[model samples]
Target: MATRKVKRLYRSDVRQARRLLRGHTRKTPVFHTDILGPRGPVPVTLKLEYLQHGGTFKVRGCLNALLQTRGDKTGVVLASAGNAGIAAALASALRGMSCTVVVPESASHTKVAAMWSHGAEVLWHGTTYAEAHKYARQLAAERGAMPLHAYDLPEIVTGAGVVGLEIEEQVRGRPPVLVAVGGGGLVAGVAVALGLRGRVIGVEPEGAPTLHAALAAGHPVDVDVSSVASDALGANRIGDIAMEVAQRYGVRSLLVSDDAIVMAREYLWREFRIVVEPAGATAVAAIQSGAYVPAPGERPVIVLCGANTDLATL
Candidate 1:
């Protein structure tokens, strides 16, 4: 199997992202969170991407990759904790291509069910997304399938950049900070989109601080995975491309706790009727737990990136 070519994100990539996601994704509402704010009611905006197709922002990248490989009937293979698998499956089904997804044992049943519903073959392996990814790569080589990485590929970053572009358009005025990070794709693309407009804060679960660890060591390095948000934000190491974009663009990384994620999840659901998974709520968790504090009257935008959790578990 050929090694996939990974490209660095740029201004042009952001432009393409907007064009690709124009009609597919919801211009998800950005609303204030009154429940978790400063003493003077610090206004916050939530980019509700949970309403996005395939139940997360993963669809944007998945569809972008499919568009690039339109003539490849050999199909594609991927491994995801949940959201990416569902997105890939849905995109492949819509494009009339075959897809096989390897998912970790820890993947939520709801996500696995959604993938199967989209007519993709689902394989369960190992105990985490990274391990499943290894197996998926092997399988793709055996099957002559193109491998689509969840967060490390250029097309994926370009597609995810749409989120940042949408946020800029939706917010009207400049926001002080945009908070989000996971495997570095979302935040890296977003950082490029912001592009000197505002600061981008990359929030990682304390248990799995891949980007944080990378920053500290001055290079990408493996980190332990033990966070509640591990499934979604659980890349052991940041991608070289993502790290390059992040460093070049001046993105900052912060750590947030699992308890904070739980609180943010419940807070959003209780206040705004928005249900998000642990990984999706990490940005909001940063603000809610005071891990990321905004300056006086500084408006911050928190991306609610996914909603793939089982409601029953909530």
Candidate 2:
């Protein structure tokens, strides 16, 4: 058997992204609270990352990738389910570069409108995101533009890792962190930053089990996406970087039911008066559903990763 070459993410890379991201992102606030566990009450911290610009953390990666294109005077192209497209468009607009976004026809109307509002030339491709991604790459090649990926890029993953660095400084004691997993970008980056200090748990909707599927298969495998959190966490397969990072750093995985995701989203509104989309609340769902039972000594941090929900749906 031969070992595969796995590209690793480094803390130094995270620091560089942090340097590049200065003045471009917000240090989203965190709230401390306790949740009931089977043993007793377990302390938990909620990282309100949904308040990030563009109402999602996608802006960090998009901005970092855009800023890195220093001398290359080229347009940008993107294929996103929702938030990433909006982030790419906004970043390009801020940099005064042209951007084109290709999205699935099934994407949220509000999300599509947001990309257009951010000055992206939005195009509707096929219904599935895979279809849109292929088309977006073709268009990028045709225009000689840079293609900004939602995940699976060193720049994008490193930018997302900055979130973990921020968490470490804001909260003491190297707490176990729970982050929602979509394409494995955010969790992978966070794991690289956190290292072995504490456990990094990736939570996902049972319907969209990309990380779980990859871990089980020992490689990235396409899975069916049909979760309430699908719009944000609907990467059909986890990226190679995420799978490798998980294997190297011992990142844990948890699956929560779709019903639990809905309930958790509602609970955030009723109990904490916090507004977040389904994907944002998915990490909390692990706790609320008892899918992840915290040890008495473990204080887990839940990252609310997105807030691009249509109020009508809420």
Candidate 3:
């Protein structure tokens, strides 16, 4: 019922999004690596999305939306926990447009700096992301600027689906993919990319179970947010498009604890010398913490999605 008015995204839409992206976004690489499993070294693929421009896959969606709305000179206004705002700012700059981002006071100072570096007018609005998002909507209306939703808009999800499309070309088989979920845009885009035959698992932090709660309620619903990964995956509710995709494809949801997220982030650094934010490590956390055990002869792909964090904290 909560998803009734949501627009459905097709695989075709993802393809169109890809076309819109053109030379704007990066085709981030996937590294085939093995993690030490319970039995032995378990093979796993890591989609190194942190290497993407703006240090996250959120740039893909932002570029897609901005490019599609190329003629609009009013610019863009959006709210993000962090990464989405940076993405929107950078993408808007790429399009020769201005960006104004309203971020919660709790947003990462590092990510806020990144947005400023991209020429975004960063404003601190509230204590939480929801409150900032509300103010951003009102601000956008007043300025007649394009309002961007971090994970709700079809362009955002479809642009992210291009990652899946790349995966299909790069990976050998239809291995299961574990993608971190905030408001469900990335996972829904992945589902469209992998199609019916491919398996896509949505991973969330237990402290911020937006998609998990939405799936359980059979509609989008708000949930309280608290997690180390909350800065990136802190959406209070899953978007309607994401909810529709979940129902249409029966996309399963899983939750990982904040401890698992932190450990996984550290593990990637220790083992691979790669750095990611807590939200980026969540998909791997599901495997590391035993939330989703890989099947025999199964090598899952974990999408490491963000790196917009303070190095001093890491």
Lowest lDDT 10-residue stretch of candidate 3: 34-43
Write down the worst ten-residue block by lDDT for model 1: 1-10
Candidate 2 whole-model C-alpha lDDT, 0 to 1: 0.87
| Candidate 3 backbone collisions, by pair | none
Instruction: After superposing candidate 1 on the true structure, give the runs of residues whose Cα lies further than 4 Å from its correct spot.
Output: 1-6, 38-40
**TM-score against truth, every candidate:** 0.93, 0.95, 0.97
RMSD (Cα, Å) of model 3:
1.2
lDDT of 1 by residue, 85-178 (tens): 8999988887788999998888878889999999999999998777999999999999888899988888888888888888888886777555
Candidate 1 Cα RMSD after full superposition onto the native fold (Å): 2.8
lDDT of 3 by residue, 95-131 (tens): 8889999999999899999999999999999998899
Ranked by TM-score, the better of candidates 1 and 2 is 2
Reference-based TM-score, model 1:
0.93
Candidate 2 lDDT tens digits, 80-183: 89989988898899899998988888888888888889888989999878888999999999888998788888888999999999999989888889999999
Alpha carbon lDDT of each predicted model:
0.80, 0.87, 0.89
Per-prediction count of colliding residue pairs?
A: 0, 0, 0
